[model samples]
Each structure stands twice: as structure tokens, then as C-alpha cells.
Target: MNALEKLKILGESAKYDLCNYVSPNLETYASGKIPGVYNSTSPDGHCMPLFKVLMTNKCSNDCKYCMNHSNRKFERYEYEPAELSRVFMDYYNKRYVEGLFLSSGVFKDIDSSMEKQVEVARILRDYGYDGYIHLKILPGTSYDLIKRAMSLADRVSVNIEAATPDGFEELTTTKNFKTDILKRMKWISRLSNDKNMAPSGQTTQFIVGAADESDEDILKRTNWLLDKFKIKRSYFSAFTPLENTPLENYESPHPKRTSRLYQADFLLSYYGFSFDELVFDENGNIETEVDPKYSFAMNNMDLFPVEVNEASYDELIRVPGIGMVSAERIITLRKRGLKIGKLEDLKNLGVAVKRAEPFVKLNKSYQSVLSF
Candidate 1:
């Protein structure tokens, strides 16, 4: 197949490796006028068009949930490093995308696969295309190649498909959880000690529900990654079974599972929440109907009706509807000697009043009844 045809397949295959926490309701790609262009959301909530595609769809690894699994019988293809760099420049010159996100399956060996991707980044850099680039570090990639990739790209990641050893064993027999994945992540962390390597930092992803792992299991792993690697972020992709694969008959998790994971992840990453502070059901899964922060508030009603004007930044962020931005606004206005004496004042500052009402007091006057 030609480069464009290969991109259509490889690009679709790359979608399973998410770079950000995108909601299901949002469109992830451009309106089909062009192929390989993806609407990737940034950490700060800005959407930038990225030329996201795989270098190849041929694989030697047997990741059961993957469409490009080694056992799958289908047309396979790969792009020459220079060919992909040229195509990306075509998109870049036209202003169609702001950056490039390159990933690949293990075509022959892990290092060879990583080399092809790094070569593409190298070609782009050689051509003076100094824009954003994110390269996927294939599991088991050599430490030196990872350091080289870090030098060329702004961000890099490895998909830690499952949380535990046994859980990983259930997914694929061809890869090792600790040696192939975690050890490589450690190398990325260590190599990252130099400020010039992947300044945007490293990230990782997990396949939700494929290993029969619970939400609690996923969050614990995320917490561990944050503490150990100080990773820039973690992404959760809800498992969707595909045809003719080993997991073809397996059921997909509720869509809300990944969404709830993102919400809870934000709380852990930004809202000053500890894993033990989170509320979970008997099954160790977060609530699908109610968001995690709201559930936390509802579970501990004793902390409700906190005086907004008097609450500390930490305390204000824990409130159900008050986010980091709004909490900062409250503190900023408070320092200016402005008192939030009414619900409308909180609303003007971007607080979700309906959600925050029951949990906050305006100038010590309770705002809403505890209907629950």
C-alpha cells in the first residue's frame, strides 16, 4: 500500500493509545477533510491539531486487545522514516496540525521498532521542524535509544496495559510486565534527570477492564506512577473488544468508567487528594452515576457548608463544585478584601453553584438544604 493508505490503517490503530483524557462526547479527529489529523487536548484544556499516526501496523507482539496483534490475519504496512517525515511536513506547512504524535507496533524487535520512530523524529529535527513531537517508547526499548528519543521529542510514553503482574499475564504472554515495561519507565525517569531530555516529560497509559482490573486497582497504579516517576500524566482507555481477536466476545466496560477515572485522576493529581481519602464501593470501583468529588463530599457530610471566605486553598479545592481555578479566584478576591457574601458572587467567579451549594456557606450563611 501507499503511504496514505498505510496512514489510514496505522492512524486508526494508534487511537487506542490515548495522549490525553478526552471525553467520549468530544470529536477526537478533524472533519475527514484530511486523514491522520487528530484533535488532541492539552493538559491545560487547549485543543491542538496533531499529526498522530503509527509508523507501522505490522507487529510481533500478541497484545490480545490490540487490532494489530501478531495473531491477527490482515493487510499490514509500514512507512519509511523519510516518507513519514515528508508527509508530516506537508500537514505542518499547510497549518493543518501543530505537532506530531508517532507510535508503532513491534514489527520485528522492540529496539528496531523504536529506532524507526526515533529516526522519523530525527529526520524532522534535521529538517528544522522544531515543533512539538511525542514518541511512543515501545516496551523493552533499549535505554540508549530511549535517551536519544528523549533528546529529539518533547514527550514520550509507554502503555502499561495492566496494573499487576498476574493482570498483565492475562493480557499477553509475549511481553514482561516488569522487565519490558516498568524497567524501561525507570530508565526514562533516570534519563530525564537532564533538563534537555523530554522537557515536556514522560507519560503512560492503561487499558481499563481488559485484565478484569477494578477502578481501585487502576488508581493505585496511577498514584504509584506519579510518586515513582513523577510522570507528567496518565491516560485511561476503556477497553473495546474487536472482531477476530481473543477478546472479541468480551464485554466492554460502561463508558462512564474511563470518564470517572479521569475525574478521580484529576483529584489525585491536582486537588490534593490521597488514595485513602477517595470513596469506593464494595467492588472497589468509583461511582458511575455520581462524580468522585461529589461522592467524596456526600460521603463526608460533616465537612460540608465550609465558610467560603474563611476556607483554606486546600479546603476550598475539596469542595464539590469548586475547582482549582475558582478556588484561586476566591483566594485572590479575598486578599483584595472582597467577601463572597452570596451564591451569585461564587458563580461570577466560575464556581458551579448548584453543585457547590450544599457544601459551602457564603459569609457563614448556609446556601442550600441537605436533601440527600
Candidate 2:
């Protein structure tokens, strides 16, 4: 097959991996825009720039959940390191892409595949290409390779795929629950803590709906990674079963659940909600109807009517509609002796008080039995 045909096949195969869609930053250029926001102009500029390319399609490991496993009977293609680099540079030069997000099947072994993956990034950097590069670290790849990959690429990831050990075992028979995958994440996390390691930190992707793991299990593991490793992001992907994979018959997660998980993750990392606070009941799933923040507010009604002028940061964050930005706004406005009487007052100040009123009280009372 030609390069475009090979890319079509490879990219089609990779669509099952959901992290490919999430944009980390919102400051991306609209198509055909010129002079492109210079990288140095704004630190937050070009956050979601598409890093599009797949290096190879051959594999050796038979991960049951993956479409490109070694034993799968399909036409396979492999791009030499130089060929892959050229395709990436061509796109980069044309300004159609900002960077390269590359991954490959385990062509020979984990280490060899990782080494070749690192070579692509190395070649890019050696030629003075300075845009974002996200590399996927294969499981069982050595620490040396991990370090080398980190040095060359701006960001890296190792897929944890399943939340629990039992779920993990059921999905990929070739993967070891004991050491192979999680260890790689731990190593990357450690390297990220080093001051000089890399500007962008480590990230991981979990395949939702592939197994019977609950939202509670997912959130708990996500929290552990955030607390233990300070990971930059924990991506939750809705499992999309492929043509011949073992999970092809399994149903994909309800998109609502996936979205809720993203919100819950944001609450854990940015908002002050704890794991226990986010889960609805003993079973550990979030309420599908109400969001985690609203659920928390409704469940703990007694905590409502907190004086907007007096509530601490933690308490204010619990209020619905009052995100970190608005919460801080309330704190600052209160200090200035501003009387936050009406919901309109908040609206005028750009605070989303609709969700915040159920949990907080303003200085002046609105006509309602509930607090402002």
C-alpha cells in the first residue's frame, strides 16, 4: 500500500484508542489561519494542536483487546524510521500539524519497539523541530528507553487500560497484572518529578466499558495516580471494540458515563471533591442524572446556605456553578465589602450563580425558602 493508504489502515485501526480525541489545550488555530500563533507568543496558545501520525502497524504481542495483535490475520504495514520522520516533517513544514503523536505495535519486543519509537523523536529533535511530541511508552520497555523517550518527546504515556487487576486479567491475557504495565507508569511518574526531565508531564489512558469496573473503581485509581505520581492528566477512553478483537461483542460505555467520569476527574484534580464524596453509594458509581458536584450539594443539603462572605475555599468549591474561578471571585468580592444579595449581582460579575445559589447565602435574601 502507498503511504496514504497505510495511514488510512493504521489510523482506522487506532480509532479504538480514545485518547486520540481529547484536546489538552483549547488555543488551537482554525484551519487555513496564517502566521499561526507563534509558539512563544502565548504559553497557552496552540494547546490542542493535532499531532497526527502512526509509525507502524506490525505487532508481536497478542493483547486480546487490541486490533493489531501479532496473531491477527490482516494485511500489515511497517514504516521505516526515516519514512515516518519524513511524513511528519512534511506536515510540520506545511503548518498542517504542530507536532507528532506517534505509537506502534510491539513489532519485535517491547524494548526494540520503544527504541525505534524513540528514534523518530530523536530524529525530529536533532533536526531542530521544537513542536510538541507525545510518545507512547510500550509496557516492559526498559527504564533507559523511558528516559531516552522522555528526553526527546515533550509528553509520554503508558496505557493502564483496566482499573482493577481482575478486569485487567480478563481483557489482555498476555499482559501481566503484577509488574509490566503499572511499573512503567510509576517509572514515568518518577522521571516527571525531576526538575529537568520534560516540560509536559506523564499521562495515561484507561479503557472504559471494556470490563465490568465501576466508575468508583476508576475514580479511586485516578485519584491514586494524581496523588502518588502527580500525573498531568488521566484520560478515560470509551472502549470501542474492533472487528476481530475479543471485545468486539462487548457494548461501548454510555457516552454520558464517560463524560461524567471526565467531570469527576476534574473535580478531584481541580475541584475539592474527594473520592468518597464523588461516589454515590456503596457500589461506587456516580449518579448518572446529576453531576458529581450537584449530587454532593443535594446529598449534603444541611451544608447549604453557607455565608458567601464567610465560607472557606474548600466550602465555596463545593457549591455548584461556582468553579475555581467564581469561587475566588466570591472571596475577593466579599473582601471588598460588596453585598452579594441577588443572583443578578453574581451574573453581572460573570459568576455562574445558578448552580451556586443552592449551596451558598448572599448578604441580601432573595424571595425563596432556599438560601441564595
Q: Which model scores highest in lDDT?
A: 1
**How displaced is residue 294 in candidate 2, in Å?**
0.7
TM-score on alpha carbons, each prediction: 0.97, 0.88
lDDT of 2 at 95: 70
lDDT by residue (269-339, candidate 2, tens digit) is 88867777775666778777878888877877778867776788788788777777777887888888876
Candidate 2 Cα errors over 4 Å, as ranges = 18-47, 364-372
What's the distance in Å from true for residue 130, model 2? 1.4
Which runs of model 1 end up more than 4 angstroms from their true locations? Answer: 21-27
Q: Could you give candidate 1's per-residue lDDT for residues 1-372 as a string of tens digits?
A: 777877787777777777653443353765356788888777678888889999998999998998998999999889989999999998899999999999998887888889999999999999999999999999999989999999999999988989888899999999999999899899999888998999998989888889978899999999999999988888888888999889999999998988899899889998889999888999999999999999998888888779999999999999988999999999999999989888889999999999999998877788887733
| Weakest ten-residue segment in model 1 by summed lDDT | 22-31
